[model samples]
Every structure is written in C-alpha cells, then in structure tokens.
Target chain A: MTPPETETETASGEGGETRTLYGSPEELPEPAREALGDLLLVLADTKRVLGIHYADWILGSPTLEAGIACSAMAQDEWGHGRILYAMLDDFGMDPERLEHERGPSEYRSSELLDEPTDSWPELLALNLLLDTALSVQIEAMRESRLEPLHHKVSKILDEERYHFEHARGWTARMASTDRGREATGEPFREAWRACLRWFGSEEDELASGLAAEGIVDAAPGELRRRWVMRVAPSVAEVEPHLVQETEDGWGSAVDPDWEGWEPRTRRLRDAPGPDDEAILSRVRGDRNRSLLGE
Target chain B: MSDRLVQIERSRPRGEGTMDWSGVAAATRGDRPDLDVPQWDEPAADLAEEARRALYEVPDPEYPISLVDLGLIYDVTADDASGRVEVTMTFTATACPCIDFIRWDVRERIREIPGVSEVSVETVWDPPWTADRITDRGRRLLNRAGVSV
Candidate 1:
C-alpha cells in the first residue's frame, strides 16, 4: 500500500506543537503503520533466530573462551530481540503473543538464519555478514522521525559494537588458515547474498513508503550500500564481488537475485524459519510457566 | 563498634551547628557522658577504599581475576548520610551471561561493609570495555590461568 501524502495531527507533547507526520504508530497512515510493524517483526524474529543459533554453539565451540564468547553473543542477541519485541506493543502488537506463540511459517526472519549452523565457519558468516546487515538497518533508524525508536536504536547499536568486534576477531582468526579460509568462503558468499536480498529491491513499495514517511532515515539502496561498505573490509578475502576497490575507495556493487523475493518478509523465497519445536522450547520456557513474576 | 558509632555521627546532617549528643548517648545505652565521639568530618575516601577492597574479593566467575582487578568496577561511591553505596561497572562483553552473578556478587560483598545500608550497581557500556581496560594484575592472573588477555 502506498502511504497517503496527507498527514494526521495527533496529541501535542512537551513543546505543545501538534505532530502531523509519523509522530507515533497511531498517528501514521495505515500503510506506514503496517510497514513499520512488519519491519519490527522482521528485526525481532531475526535476532531471536540468531540468538538461538548462537546458543547452539556455546558448549561446542573449539575453545573455552570461544564458548564463553558464544554465550555472550547469544545473550546479546536475545536481549536485543526482547527489546525489539517489546517495542512492538507501541505498534499495537501483543509482544508476548508475538514472541511465544509464533510458528515457523509465521516468522519474518531472514532466510540466512532459517536453519541451525552446522559449522563454525557458517556461524562466523552469520555473525560477521548477516549480523552486520541487521545492525546497518537498525543504524539507519538512529535518527528516525519516530521518536520512540531513538533511545532503543542507540542502545541496541551500542551493544552491537562488541558483536561486530567479536565477529571480526573470529573471522580474521579463521581466515588466517588455508583450510579455514576455504571452509568459510561458501558460507560467506551465501550469507552475503541473503543479506543483499534481505534489504529488498530499491523498488519495494513498503521500503519506499516507509522511507517517504520518515520512519527510517535511508532508502533501501542506501542502507544496502552502507552495509556492504562496512562488511566489505572483513570479507574481502572471501569473494571479489563482495568488495571492489575503486579510485575513490573500496565499495560493493554485487547485484543479488531479487526475483521471487517476498518484499514484506524480505526473504528470497517462501520457506519456514527455524524448527518450531526447537525455537519454542527455548523461547517459551514451559518449565517456568508456573513461576510468577519475570 | 566504634567505627559504627563514628559512621552514625558523621551521617548527621551538617549546618545544624551543634548536634544533640545526649540523644545519641542515650541511644547507645551508656550512662557515661564521657564517650569521645571521633571526628565526624572524615572524608568518604575511607568508605570508598573499603568498598573497593570488598569488591576486590568478588572474583569473576569465568576468570581467576577479581572484578576490581579486571577493571570492571569503573567507579565506587558512597553517600555517608544515607549509607547508600553506588557502583558503576561494566562486563568484559555486553553479552556476558554472568552479568547477574557478577552484579549479585558485587552487591553482596559491598553490603557486608558496616556503614553500607544500601548498594546499587549500575552497568554502563559507554567507552565500551576492551582488553586494554584489563589491569596489569588481571593480565598476570589470566596468564597464570593459561588464558591470553
């Protein structure tokens, strides 16, 4: 749905100025509200799945420190997911229902996290490439006209710095070895393609409408460019198209297959997310159902 | 006991010019009026030092080093009047699963101090923690534990 050009006035704030443009979810046009809600769900689901994947390796990591790092990253991802899910309450979503009751097919998470990672290299690819892509999208909302996202976006990004560092450190360590480098190449390329597709095509009506509503600071193309620029340096060894050195500097211009893409979910094809039993068991915590107070 | 008495005395509101020592004397259940109340103007430096020493005993769950030695305790302060202690701290990583354990340990250890009536730990992320933040002693401990800083 295209966002109506007209704006609606809502309640005034401390300054007593009437906000007529994307002030709150209720104030937004129907299209803008739906788009924002979809975006938040996508982000929350991606983080939730990523956290689950990270938790799978906590005990299986090659070293004690690496395992601890996985635990840390998992906690960070879960915390971020919780925050994002809670924010959906403002968008008229029942946060609890959204988190605990969602089935595999209902999740709007990126396809990159559709399955549990089987190898450390695959994990690193998700960590370094896909995680950064999510961060890049969140970073675009740092100055979002939607005031509620300001502090949440900033805090989430702040925590994400360590995630980036952790991923970069591990990626560099793995890439240093001949076998390790070879192992990571395909996973990295696969993750790169998913991230590109996750950003959607520039012509996506939802993306354009959201941008027009000022809910997000950048368009899809700009968001993708920033993501590629940030990720290019770390994965430069994996693929040439991942990063291209220009006279101006290194940049990425890889064109992913946007055909058969689901613009709303931002996924390349129709596929259920992670296994419902696995995700729900961890997320829902049935054993704690009788316990009172969070 | 003397230190406790001193804390109570120092905690009295200033600018009253004079304190009613008779009330304190009665409260102590002592008939003697000759109790020499120690100087009540001591800086909070002693309390801060004591809190720091207490925190040094609280070790990181995963590492051999204490939280204080690990440079996790950025700052510790106490409000003498309220007997409230506040500590600003950070974890080795933002996603540290031991955050609850570490925070609980810090609070428990500091609350054991005589003058501390309340303890609050504020976890911060600004100027995000790095290996460089680890102290020399912490590095030595990690090295001894077969871990690299």
Candidate 2:
C-alpha cells in the first residue's frame, strides 16, 4: 500500500531518533484510526462518570481538605472529557451527540463506576485502583505517535499528578490500621480485578494493534505492569495477597478473568449498568436542558 | 529554551465575530506553519506585546495582581495583519472557580487593544502552571498585595 500524502509530525524520541507521528486522524491507517477513536471514547466516557463518582464523595468526605480535593478532581475530569469530546469530530463522530445522546447501554466507562461508590472505602478503591489505571494508560501515550494527541495526553498527565498523591495519601492512611485496612480490603480487591482487566489481555486486537501503530507507547501487558507498580506501594499493605512484589518491580497475584471482558468498552458488559444511568443523565445535562445555550 | 526558542507563528485571517476558544496549532510551538499564510515580519510580534501590556490592566478577581504578572498567561502572539491575538494560558489549579470570569475577562481585555479586533484564548495543562513561571514584576506586585510569593 502506498503512504497517503499527508503532513506527518515527527517527535524527537529517546536516543535522538525521530519517529513519525500521524498529524491528523484521517492520516492514520484504517485499523489504527478505529482503535484510537474507540480507546479515546472509552476514556472520555469514563472520565465523565469518574468525575461524578468523585463528586459524590465531596460533601461527606472524612476531612474538609479531602472533600475539597474530590471537588477539584471532579472538575478536572469533566474538563478533560470536554477537551477529548471536542476532538471527536475529526473521527467522524459528533461531539454533542456522543456526550448527550448516549444511554446506559451505550456508555463505555467501567462497571466499577456503574453506580455511586457506597462508602468512603469504595471511593478510595476507585481512586487508587481505577483512577490510577486511567493515568497509567494516559502516561503510555505521552509520546504518542498520534501527534495531535501526544501533547494533550501530556497535559492530562500533568493534571493527574495531584490525583495520584490524593489516592496514595488516602490509601496509606486507610491501610495504616487494622480497622481501616479491614474496611478497605474487599473494595480494593474488587477494584483491582476490574481495573486490571480494563487494560485488556495479551491477545486483545485493539490493544495490540494500537501498540504496533505506536499510538500508545506501551502494549497492554506493559501498561498493566505500570498500573500495578503505581498502585502497589499504598494498596499492597492492606491487600497483601492481591499484590506481589517482584524481584525487579511489582506484579499482581491474581490474573484477570476474561470471561465477560469487552475489549472496545473495557468493561464486563457492553455498556454501563442500569444503575449508572442516573448520573450519566446528569452528565448529559438532562436536568438543565433549558439553561444550555447550545 | 533550545535553538527553537522562538515558537511564534504568524496568525491567519478569521471571522471577527464570536468569542470562544480557538485553535492554537499554528500559534503553538513546534508545529509546522501553515504554508498559505504570509509570515508577519516584525509588527506581528510587536502587536502581541501590545496585547500583553493591555493584560496588565485586568486584575485577577481574587487577587489584585495582574494576570500577566501572576503567570497565568502562557504565550501571547498577535497577527497585525488579521487583528487576532492568540493567548495560550493555564490556571493554577484545575478547580479554580474563577476560570469562567477569568476567560471572559481575558477576551474583553485583549479586545481593548487597538489592533486586536479578534481574540483567541487557548488553555493548556501540559507543563502545568508553576510558581517559576511568574515574572520578577509579578513577585513585586504580589508582595505589595500583602501576599508572599
């Protein structure tokens, strides 16, 4: 196949070698373009839901500062989602329709966020396990060969540093005591399994195809390793059996069960559960339809 | 700060109406310039400076210090030919509640300049805003405002 004549940006990669980057979505190979669009939709949808999940805990948090942090993180998620959704028009998708028209069966966020976190421990689990997974995945695209997105990815990663500190700080605090640890243990395990599976498995066509195209810097297994290494130090103490410290770095003791895993949506089901619809409705601004200028 | 210290690009013509976020790819650093637009020699750079000088008049809602001095304005460049000034900026935190007001304030302030009929404010998060981005003038202003930098 002949390369289409398109302006390709080049990134100064490690070791001083320059790698070609796709300047626009139209320039990408068919499979890679589809994979990237799918991946981005999943991420944007999850950020919107995750923002609400964070917002749910803002008022009742254990500390004022923690509640404030939740408020801030929630805003960041919505802002991030808007930026991503705005760019979907280039992928032949309508940004407004994607954000407003989707139903529960159409959302691409994880099942973990299918409902509001029931307790502080559950929210913390989503923070350390689920949020960190999203960050690590974004980190892999910091030098994405998809040129337009690489800088945007870096911007999102910079904003996420505080989120990690928030998660790590709260995780250590909760895991520090027997009572705190016991309350957080089950939630962490459930969250870990879901997030670990979110990266998909070795044979995932979408994950592997994107890797070959250099859209995401690392492959699925590598991304999972980064996710585990990121979450282990704070989360491992409480869920000792769930995480394993390797000779070199970190590992997960329980491998992901792929029975219900859906690659495109990165969830157990094809879309969010019915319980997730209420908040998803709010994300669509169903209540304030009259106020929206658009 | 490398050899490519100059990330400035000549702005292209646009409709003068509507005040929303605009594309920064042409004005952003390291992007290949749009071949169709004629490069502005020097007056373009000067117009951007004029826009920046104007921002000193707009104080942050919470603080008295100018937004320029506070380091919120990332990059300011103007196209004298098109009368458009593109300002790339960031907030101190994602949760800054004053962002909407700040953005409106920015557009209004830039429009006050004589050669600036169109204003574009693009917000970025990468290399997130830090105290180090604040200018020495900002420090003195902050000090005067009873806030230690």
Top candidate on TM-score is 2
**How close is chain A of candidate 2 to the true chain A, as a TM-score?**
0.95
Residue A65 CA displacement from its true place in model 2, Å: 2.3
The residue ranges of model 2 lying beyond 4 angstroms of the native Cα positions read A1-5, A8-11, A270-277, B1-46, B94-96
Candidate 2, residue B15: Cα displacement in angstroms equals 16
Q: RMSD in Å for candidate 1, one decimal? A: 12.7
Where does candidate 1 stray beyond 4 Å?
A1-23, A286-294, B1-149
Each candidate's DockQ? 0.06, 0.22
Q: Categorize the docking of model 1.
A: incorrect
lDDT (10s digit) by residue, model 1, range B106-126:
776788898889887766543
TM-score of each: 0.64, 0.85
Ten consecutive residues with minimal summed lDDT in candidate 1 chain A?
Answer: A1-10
| Interface RMSD, in order shown | 13.4, 6.0
The candidate scoring highest on DockQ is: 2
Candidate 1 has a TM-score of 0.64
lDDT of 2 at B63: 58
Model 2 TM-score is 0.85
